[model samples]
Target: MFRNFGKRTEKAPDADTVVPLWPQNGSAAEAEPSAEDRKLSAFLELKSRMHEALIERLNLAVIDKVEPEELRREVASLVGDVLAEENNPLRADEFRRLVDELIDEVLGLGPLEPLLADPGVNDILVNGHKTVFVERAGVLEQTGVRFRDEKHLLRIIDKVVSRVGRRVDESNPWVDARLEDGSRVNAIIRPCAIDGPSLSIRKFSRDPLTLEKLVAGYALNAQAAAFLQALVEARMNILISGGTGSGKTTMLNAISASIDPRSRIVTIEDAAELQLQQAHVVRLETRPPNPAGGGAVSQRDLVRNALRMRPDRIIVGEVRGAESFDMLQAMNTGHDGSMTTVHANSARDALGRIEQMVSMIGMELPLPAIRAQIASGLQIIVQLARLADGQRRVVSISELTGLEGDVITMQDIFIFRRLGKAADGSIAGEFIPTGIRPQCTALLEAAGARFDRAMFLPEEA
Candidate 1:
């Protein structure tokens, strides 16, 4: 049943079927350029010219109103015509790459588009026009990505802030904004940024991490996760404390999933990054003052408003200022299941920070009064840390046992014991129970929650 067209033989591939002139990894890794490199360089030069010509041909002011697919097709047609007129020798793959880059340049953040799309990249740090760095798996690495010049970088920054209804100029040298996908961005330009404009993007995951994922990643042990769930379900106020980039928000999001869906939860934030999953929830974000220095809204204002909304639980993204006092008042006065995060190195430091922030509001409260409030309002403090090896883990979980002679007392219920660094450079640690049952066990039991006693027993070494 077989028909032979000819003898099967190997043949030299066509030019279009050959490997792309650009590197396979999308980075120019080689120090020396081959003959094909010259062709690639020439094509890049031509693409730059075509990019400028295409920009001039389109009315950018109205570009956002156009359908993306339609705009891409129109741009492709124009690019094809230009390619034909130039009569440059380009392989089919290279021609398609040129079109995609041109489209990104016109409609997106030019040099950052590809980086933003990469799922492996956790943070994008743009130091200036020529330098770009990315944090992958908590390790910072430089990339080959670059802009045409400083002006081009400035354009990209403006494009980002403008979409969020914010601005960055000589007068306003810095701005905080969020991308459509919810990545938190902070940009500081000239004057403030001595060298040049610097942008930091804390990339948000498309699918927020859940408690199970955090356990699977060895961020915490199963016992701790179960205990935390019980605490949330029992309406215990929790303060997630950690340093910058220490996964405090991530932990907050994971634990918030345990909140009762029927309860009305209100979340406040500076840039609005919390993704709470409860059915009945309201989100609020603080607003910066206008150019004339009016119409500003603070987290304290949002917190005050959230109180009147009859929220069963209040969640603040991070308490950086006097809002800490309002947040604690809410927690103490009937909002038993409230949760928030603070930047601190340990559970005790977290309490100190809250005290300092409370004093900032000029409440004129004595230190003992503030400590009493914190101890009575907050039941659990979950401390997180990013280890030297770039692994983020729940380093400690403590229970505030109330004030001991004017000093707030806390006992660790669970702790991470570091053995040392592993061969591959990862910090090796064991999340072990401290064998001390939380004083809130009676309160949780009164709320109809049950837990295994052995969960609090320390492991045998």
Candidate 2:
């Protein structure tokens, strides 16, 4: 028979509501309280009984215990007054490391974690968790580390994106963040990810690569160095070209070293890698959106911003898109001596890439107008390529001489030819001159630059 009055019956504790904290996916440790606290204590007696009953009735411990420091006071607080009996026992250092442990176990094998430690890895890429790669010596190589699974990868993705105040989920599953080491990180989760979660990190060197070290590394020869120095002194607009592991940026840095100390330089980059040592140098980096997904800064924004700051030279780290047009326009207007690097297989390809990028500027400018922009605004294109032995060499030095009808005209001022190698199997080549000094030598002279022919000797090579 049913009772007329409303009645309530006691409900059983949930057996499956025991969701894990921290990782929300994986691992932790349990530690006993102090012997004094654990032995001969009514509190310990009460907890042990509750634990037994809860485990028997609900198939879960009333309190899944952790060492205070490891559990973290703030996170432990989320468990509610049910854990009010616990002491705040975490020491600062232990808490931090335990947090790291939680992150590592949670994150599993997200590649960016290790990359933050690798000094050589300048960049990292993830088509997805199963496919991860890094850039070394300007070349890409896949790494052995990987996430245990997609969820394992997501935890780390959460920590990183959250730190940078970005997000990744079903709705908006892509984000960019910077590591503690200042490496740039980009991540994409499902929906946007055709595969699993994809990630990329452009790692940073703790110390900037210097010009002297570059010469020692055989990236630039003496004859090439002197000529490049002369170009910088002359304020010639220079574009460096190379394939994906090429030393374009390294070469650009060495060449930029030749600029007179008196002039001001503004360096703009998506990842801020350049390290110029001039007294008046100003460096600007682009910013990705915040966690709430607002406040983004771009290359073109920096370029336009640099103009108002009165830059003597605007050095862009690399030109990958429509920024080529803005760069060329800046070069033509007044930013002569501006230097930048571009991805290309050869000098000709760099030109073509620029031509294509200028098209991306969304203008219907005729090929001739673009060609004219290239010829008039740019002065030289120096090409770099990585050899089999992993050496980055300055292979070609060409000048944008002028225009031929609608086509841009270029002339080689200096070229590197592969002479036979020495007995040691080390690379031996002539960074020989083409016997045509750049016309800009006269311009440099007018600017009070002092130079002589012997200054182009290969001693520095």
User: Which one wins on TM-score?
Assistant: 1
| lDDT for residue 165 in candidate 2, whole number 0-100 | 57
TM-score of each: 0.88, 0.66
lDDT (tens digit, per residue) of candidate 2 on 1-461 = 22222223365325553433234222343344556444334432333333333334331242235454644453333322333346434455644543453333333333356666677776778776556787776568987655545765787678776765556788677765666555567788888887788877666567755556665766655566666776788888999999865767667766777887999899988765565768999988777665566798889888989989999999999988888888999999988899999999888888889999999978888998898888898898999887765667888889888887877778786777888777866567766767776767678678766566654333423
List pairs with backbone clashes in candidate 2.
122-203, 138-245, 165-291, 166-291, 222-461
Alpha-carbon local distance difference test for all models: 0.88, 0.70
Q: After superposition, how far is residue 427 of candidate 1 from its true place, in Å?
A: 1.0
What would the per-residue lDDT of candidate 1 be over residues 1-461, giving only the tens digit for each residue?
Answer: 11222333276444465434443453555656777656555665676788888988888899889998888888878888887887865677877788888888888888789999999999999998878999999999999777766887898899998987888998889999988877899999999999899999999888899999999999998889989999999999999999999999999999999998999999998887888887898988888888998899999999999999999999999999999999999988999999999999998899989999999998699889988999999999999999888889999999999888998899999999999888998888899998898888988888876567688998631
Cα lDDT for residue 117, candidate 2: 69
